[model samples]
Target chain A: DVKVTQSSRYLVKRTGEKVFLECVQDMDHENMFWYRQDPGLGLRLIYFSYDVKMKEKGDIPEGYSVSREKKERFSLILESASTNQTSMYLCASSQGTGSYGYTFGSGTRLTVV
Target chain B: EDQVTQSPEALRLQEGESSSLNCSYTVSGLRGLFWYRQDPGKGPEFLFTLYSAGEEKEKERLKATLTKKESFLHITAPKPEDSATYLCAVRGGYSSASKIIFGSGTRLSIRP
Candidate 1:
């Protein structure tokens, strides 16, 4: 079974603070993704990493950035967290291009006050 | 632009009732379609993946079928535990990394 674990389940931060959400996968997947899920907007991609030190901007990557220093870990960073950045952040990983399914972390609900 | 749309924003069903959830999509090229079940305050759990038209996959009382433009997840004699938000996602062929676009999801409620 594949396991994807997030660093935090819930977090609270003041406005203009820097926030970091970490995700680790045990399956040695090559692709990792970060997304923020909202009520009506659905899960919008924030960033994704295909390999170590390789990153790409997803649809909604303006306020967010990501790091993939290693194959098993991916981190999402908020340069200056604002109240609007509060959301349920999700991390997912998949083995390869041909593999369709993804293993997801439990998610981190961040609250920016 | 690639997109995924799930219909029937919410559903209420009695135990033993049967129904189906719909997911329609438009993309330049289709790589795969995925189904997931999510409870409140939790991340999605992978359920099934449909790679092509005419493909079907099943688990327990849930069955998923795919067509050229849409996919259906049929629940047969559902139970209370089957209540959750069903999500659909599509992988576009343009990216080699298999970037996925997700739908807003359909919330299902089963009462006994």
Candidate 2:
């Protein structure tokens, strides 16, 4: 089955630490996205990439960055982890024009302390 | 601005109950509306995608219909296994058509 796989399901990081969250897709989609879901705030996009080595900032990309070195893999990086960054992070991928529904990974729940 | 709002943040129904979840949206231009089912601690599973008004799609006990301003996910004869959070999202014809906005979601609980 076509799938988006996130490297970790749960992660704990210390404040000021640099964090990396990895995502890989088997579907060879051209678009990949990173979002953080929080209580009462829903899901907020942090960044997205439409092609390898091409990344764009989403609505909430202040403390985050992304790397799409390869077509099937996208990585989300936290410059410096903070307590406010604790939330469930999701990764999704889509193909073609991206008008279709996305295939999402199970998600990574991260805690910063 | 693009925005999505889902009604009835939480709903509780007995087995065999039928109901609908609402997803209201406003965007520069509507490209697609999507419905997803998310079990606790899991990612959202794609259910349906409606491109225009009056379009409908069905799977098992779930049906999704879209209109110019909103979309609805109707559940018929729901069972306990159907209990999950339903999420609605919209893709707009904005500069970045690839960006999708998601609503807070409706948590549905079906009691057997």
Candidate 3:
């Protein structure tokens, strides 16, 4: 079985504060993704990394960035958190090909006050 | 742009009853369609992946079928434990990588 673990399950941060959400996958998948899920918006992609040091912006990438220094770890960074940034953040990983669906982490609910 | 829409934002069913959830999508070229079950406050758990129109996959009481423009997930004699948010996603087009677009999901509730 594949395991995807997030660094924090819940987090609270003040406005303008820097925040980091970490994710690690044991499957060594080549594709890693960061998504923010809202009530009506579903899961909107924030950023994705296909390989180490390679990143691409998804549909909604404003105020957020990602890092993939290693194959097993992907990190989502909020340069300066705002109240609007509060959301349920999910991390997922998939193989290079388009055959398999993503394996998701438990998700982190971030509250920016 | 690829878009996915799940019908019946919410559903309520009695235990032992059966029903189907619909996922409609429009994309340039379909690569795959996926079904996932998400529990409250948790990430989605993958259920099925349908690649072609006539493909079908099943696990236990849940079965998924695909067509050219949509997919259906049918639950047979559902139990309370089967209650969850069912999500659909599609992967398609040439966007440097395989990017998946997800639907808002249909929340299912089973009454005991």
Candidate 4:
């Protein structure tokens, strides 16, 4: 089946540490997105990539960045992890301009302390 | 600003109960509306997409209907396995990238 795979299901990080979350998609989609879901806040987009090596900031990209080195892999990076940055991170990919629905990965729940 | 809003934050029902979940949106030139089901500790799974007013779609016991300003997901004879957080999202023409806006979601619980 076509799928988006996240490298980790759960993670624990220390404050000020640099963190890396990896995602890979089996489908050759052109668009990839990173979102953090929080209670009462819903899913807030951090960044998205429309093509390889091309990345754009989403609404909440202050403490995060992204790298799309290959057609199937997109990575999210936290330059300096903070306690408040802890949340469930989701990776998603779409075929075109994102007018259609997206196939999402199982998600990574990161806890920062 | 463009936004999507879901009501009742949560709902509880007995098995075989039928109900509907609401998603209200205020967006410019709506492109599409989407419904997803999310289990605890898992990612959101795509369920349905409604593109225009009067459009409807169904799968098993779940049916979705859309209007100009809102959409409804109607559940018929729900089961315990159907319990999950239902999320609604919308894409708009305000941007070239077709950015999507998501709602807070409505958590549903079914008692057998």
lDDT of 4 by residue, B5-82 (tens): 998799999999999999999999998899999999999999999999999999999999999999999999999999
lDDT by residue for model 3 (B52-103), tens: 9999999999999999999999999999999999999999886548788899
Each candidate: fraction of true contacts kept?
0.68, 0.70, 0.65, 0.75
Clashing pairs in 2: none
lDDT by residue (B1-112, candidate 2, tens digit) is: 8899999999999999999999999987787899999988888999999998999999999999988998999999999999999999998875544578899999999999
CAPRI-wise, candidate 2 is medium
Candidates in order, TM-scores: namely 0.97, 0.96, 0.97, 0.97
> Model 2: per-residue lDDT, tens digit, A1-113?
67999999999999999999999999889899999988788888899998999998998999998999999999999999999999999999988584777889999999999
Task: Estimate every model's Cα lDDT from 0 to 1.
Answer: 0.92, 0.92, 0.94, 0.94
Output the number of the DockQ-best candidate: 1
Q: List runs of model 1 lying over 4 Å from the truth.
A: none
Candidate 1 C-alpha lDDT tens digits along B1-112: 8888898999999999999999999977888899999999999999999988999999999999999999999999999999999999988776676678889999999999
In terms of docking quality, model 4 is medium
Question: Which ranges in model 2 have alpha carbons more than 4 Å from their true place?
Answer: B94-96
TM accuracy, model 3: 0.97
Looking at model 1 chain A, report the run of 10 residues with the lowest lDDT sum. Answer: A95-104
Put down candidate 1 lDDT per residue, A1-113, tens digits, no spaces. Answer: 99999999999999999888999999889989998999988898899888999999998899888889999999999999999999999999997777477889999999999
